[model samples]
Target: MTEAGDDTWLARNRATLARLQFAPQARSVGRVEHVADGIALVSGLPEVRLNELLRFETGQLGFALTLDVEAIGVVLLDQSESICAGARVSGTGEVVRTPVGQGLLGRVVDPLGRPLDRDEALGETVFMPVERAAPAIIERDPVSEPLATGILLIDALFAIGRGQRELIIGDRATGKTSIAVDTIVNQKDSDVICVYVAIGQRATAVQRVIDAVRRHGAPERCVFVVAPAAAPAGLQWIAPFAGMTIAEYFRDQGRHALLVIDDLTRHAATHRELALLTREPPGREAYPGDIFYLHARLLERAAKLSGELGGGSVTALPIAETDAGNLSAYIPTNLISITDGQIVLDAGLFAANQRPAVDVGLSVSRVGGKAQTAALRHASGRLRLDYSQFQELEMFTRFGGITDARISAQIVRGQRIRALIRQARFAPLPESVEVALLGALADGLFDALPPACIATARERLLAGAISGDEAAAVRARLDGIVQDLTREAGHRPSDGASAP
Candidate 1:
């Protein structure tokens, strides 16, 4: 059909469509018939509703219709030749990509990068496709760069590097999301660009995240992409890609970007459902066998390409939620294998009120040593050996008094390691604090402090009141606290068989 003829046919079709009341297919696109003052209704579709997805042209522009369905009776937006009538309506062509450019900061966007909050219009975006090839191995630099999170457990023990794939696996309500959020907020002044992709989150939850991100005053440094629970399943599947595309814009300009796919469980689940609907073969739990491939491709996009190419990096922290804290499940294991390393959060530890309650003995950082400083690796490596031996012996000796002085000494060091890593916030620690905490634990500065006093000393150290040589002064005060506690117990080791 000629272009003018097509427009005439579409206009008639839209008139008939408005009178008919039928729900469109789950995945279809429609054109805006009219647009005025940032409000528009698409032609040939039932009045654009509050949550319906709509597109302009074949794929040039798209957004989730945010206006009330009742108010969209017959009015249409954009009377242009292409969007008039009989325009093809289907799911958004290709994944909804983020429009690259400045001012995307501080905006809460849907998977398609449309403004979710209606605060402002996105203008003049430099676009990039969602499905991008991983940078070639030769073009990529090694992950020898450290990205300090400021958490003792992570910085000193499980260091995360730029362009690294670190998995955050945990059961629900274990503060997994909190950890990711805190990390982003703490990067305000660190020159790190952060993108947080919320897949299948609640609308209220997305709002809260936007508020928190704004509160941090790093809107220019952060980009938030949200796919709420009620959005079409296809949107949820594409949310992470949208976030990554935004980060890639900055990284390509020689800037470092940190992309967090918080709770990829939802994305995985959505992909599984789509695979089934498309009649793909099912593997474990009816999930597609190629499930691993989907994740691997997405995560492989993160890399530190050499200066000859971009001189930038995109570090990925992808979180996966497991059932009942079971990492042996199908999805968790698939992700574990694809990523460089995993940070497994323990539910039992969380329940015990261990804020940021990571089970130190259980979590392993395959690339941790490579990402950390020489001093950190040396100190923490020894600390781990000491703590492991003490815990094994403590299990057998807990039934009686003072089994051995050597075992008692080890217990003190073990307790100190735990206390030092205990943090309530997800803020990344300064590099100096990371070194001091590891140094103190290695040197037995914590040997004398009681468990409670040890916790207090850790808080003081992180507060930055003590640093460099002054950290020793704080340790001296802790020594006094320990001596006072030990004196009250008097002659404890002398009477080996006595309980008190």
Candidate 2:
């Protein structure tokens, strides 16, 4: 067509679209030709766009995932058992969206933004699209400030930053969700809002998580987006994006938000199922090759916006499950490359009674010292390396070889440090408290304590430091602890070698 003719045709089409958009009840109806595995192929919904929702004659909802020459593939968002062939379907001309605003806080909602909690009637509905383009690189700022997960070991070593995308990858039951949950619990006093997206999880398990957040007194600052096991695969696939969109709303409003995708392994599996149903070409492990892009786009939404805009951020803590701790598997490896870093958990450490089971050697934070408080930064200077050395030496000494005094003392210090990091669930320590304990350790204060009694001594001393005023007794005890450390470090041991 000639340029003028093309422009004229486009103008006419734009006018027609405008009219259709403003017209009331301008719905295009279609008929379901086939229904299987929660997906329906409709033959007459020609006006439907990709990802557009449709309403059936039976009032069920779906979205157009594929549009072929003769049929449109619709993924049902609800139960499909009642839906069958020859059912009428009408295009709603709207994409899926979720409720987003201050009102959504403390509410447990499904992917479609329906209130799952008794107290939430979805007041002040400000809905936003579940899929949004990530902020551009220029709109982003450096992630320097700490998110303060309140776990001493993580805060001291593998610090997470606001607007950073960090993956938590490990085998099942290896404390991945626990870390995310603990981080949410730790945000009780902060201005940060939290969105917990539970995809493909059991209803009882989701309830337990909700209860834990409630018990931590942080429910008011958190939103729950759950697509339980009973939900359709489509809902499970959209749940994380819905949660991300909610967090984006808060970020755009000049508030910080944290999003926890409980685990993307199941999310990926759901997407794989949908892709298979839609007849897409499956790649490795039967997952579509675009799976990497799926996660990358989602994680890219986590950015520290520049000061010119609202200095808000959406920090993503995406969890992924590894089969038998095989992180080299396709999905886990894909996530590892997409995120800034990962917190690796070890089942061996879990069996050894480590609460978090964080494998220090494997876990790393690219943000590093910049994401840590100065006090924590100073206190944690040599903690990781020292701990690694201690582990090596202890393992070496197990062969019943020579026992150097330096190695023995180092092992003792490592034992004390390990005990120091053992924390109970829901007990997220404050930054100051962590700094004090770690600083005391850095100052050689805890090495003199008995290894088995390290936890008790730390609690007593920390309690004295936190609640007990600068009393003479507290000061004297602290001083005595420091003196003992000095004595332990300086004492000449019989047949002693150089200190490690």
Candidate 3:
């Protein structure tokens, strides 16, 4: 009986084994011929594609940047110190991808989707390629809704719209980052998700931004992608792209998102370094000829989807640094041309005690009044024209005493306008409060009150309850509030002064 059972078991196992098939597979593996400066020259992976991920023997990762008949240029995403010449490199048959989804919210990460804030798992999520094509013209809808910055100047003048790419150009320390942070803080009660990518910034600086948003804004709705100055050039270069991919996930889900690339000047420099390292011919400013295309492709991804796609949008505010207010510089100009509009900050005005010194004449929104709220569009109709005229007249009056009563009164009104727009950092006005203040100024509500009184009135108005639905009601309530503040300050409003 035992012999019969053993024979039956062996026959069954042999039958199953005889039904199996075996096959041989081949992989394209290359060897690093040269390695240095976060780049490597590999020589045997003839089948490798451009931008495909590469795995090295040292457990480091890189991407094929330039493919040649003889060698492939690779950019290392991890530290290159461990990778040496003759190291084995294998093609992963995949491009660089990052984790994307709600799992990324409230977490700080690198360009590779690795968590940087804490040792928590990202949970189950989908991966998306960092580089993606922009939406076609037919797939995109017009940017009709406003993305409020809560800044009186930006809201009243250069109103930014959802799905728009607005460039923030300024000299160092002129409050470029501050403006972006304020915008994020202002979205505390909004449904829009925020993605802040800090490229080549200091550790402390990146920390400050995270702290500010956590303290003043809704941290639960934000994602911070940090590639500090000390990070590898490859990481910094990919930081913004990874962030855009993350934001795109939300937009695809029919939700709105905002992306802030803290500054791209460093990214351009990083590109130049890599270009020179890889022996690419240098163009203007020693950058590669494809620099413009590089950014254009990245920024063009920000768009408002058509209604059929769920009416979602991605608004991008990319910051660019200028040398001594030089907007004509290569990087700044490139960004200015790519964005829907540019918000130029003046260091001179900044030094003059005007915080967030936005150059109104130079800062223009191509979307213009179309993206503005009905109340703001109505209240600020003639404000810019009068303010520009006042600026010109005030400059002339500084040269000599003005005898004309009209010119003198114009200067007074211009001064009031300047004082009204002066805003402090971290204090963003709501849309309703902004409309109310602008309306009050348009109605000659602050002509006689001094600058100090105007500040006091603004603080009071900010504290008061205001609604954005009814502009006229808010303006009426603002009138009473301003009158009370002026009376408390022992000052009276002008009886017949015309609005600026």
Tens-digit lDDT string for candidate 2 (1-500)? 69999999999999998887554555577999999988999998678899998999999999988788899889999999889899999987789987898888889999998888885487666888899999998999999978989899999999999999989988889899999999999998899999999999988988999999999858988999999988998899889999999999989988899999987999999889988888889999999989999998888889999998899999999999998889889999999999999999999999998988999999999998988877679878888998998789878888796557777778877887888888878877777667667766666655555555556655655665654343344535655554554456564321212124
The Cα local distance difference test for each model comes to: 0.69, 0.85, 0.89
* RMSD vs true structure, all candidates: 11.5, 8.8, 2.4
lDDT of 1 at 229: 79
Q: Model 1: per-residue lDDT, tens digit, 106-166?
A: 6677766778777689766776666677888998998888877766676766788888888
Over the stretch 1-500, how does candidate 3's per-residue lDDT look in tens digits?
99999999999999999998978989888899999989999999989998999999989998988888889989999999988898999999999999998889899999988999999989667999999999999999999999999899898889999999999999999999999999999998889899999999999999999999998999899999999998888898899999999999999989999999988999999999988888899989898999999999999999999999999999999999999888888888888889999999999999898878999889989997889989889888788888899989978878888998887777877888888899997888878778878877887888767767788778866776654546666667777776777677788745635543
Candidate number with greatest lDDT: 3
Superposition-based RMSD of candidate 1 using all C-alpha atoms, in angstroms: 11.5
Top candidate, metric TM-score = 3
User: By summed lDDT, which 10 consecutive residues of candidate 2 come out lowest?
Assistant: 491-500
What TM-score, to 2 decimals, does candidate 1 have? 0.75
Total backbone clashes of model 3?
0
Candidate order by decreasing lDDT: 3, 2, 1
Model 1: weakest 10-residue lDDT segment is: 491-500
Q: Point out the higher-scoring one by TM-score: 1 or 2.
A: 2
Off by over 4 Å in 2: 1-27, 462-500
Which model is ahead, 1 or 3, in terms of lDDT? 3
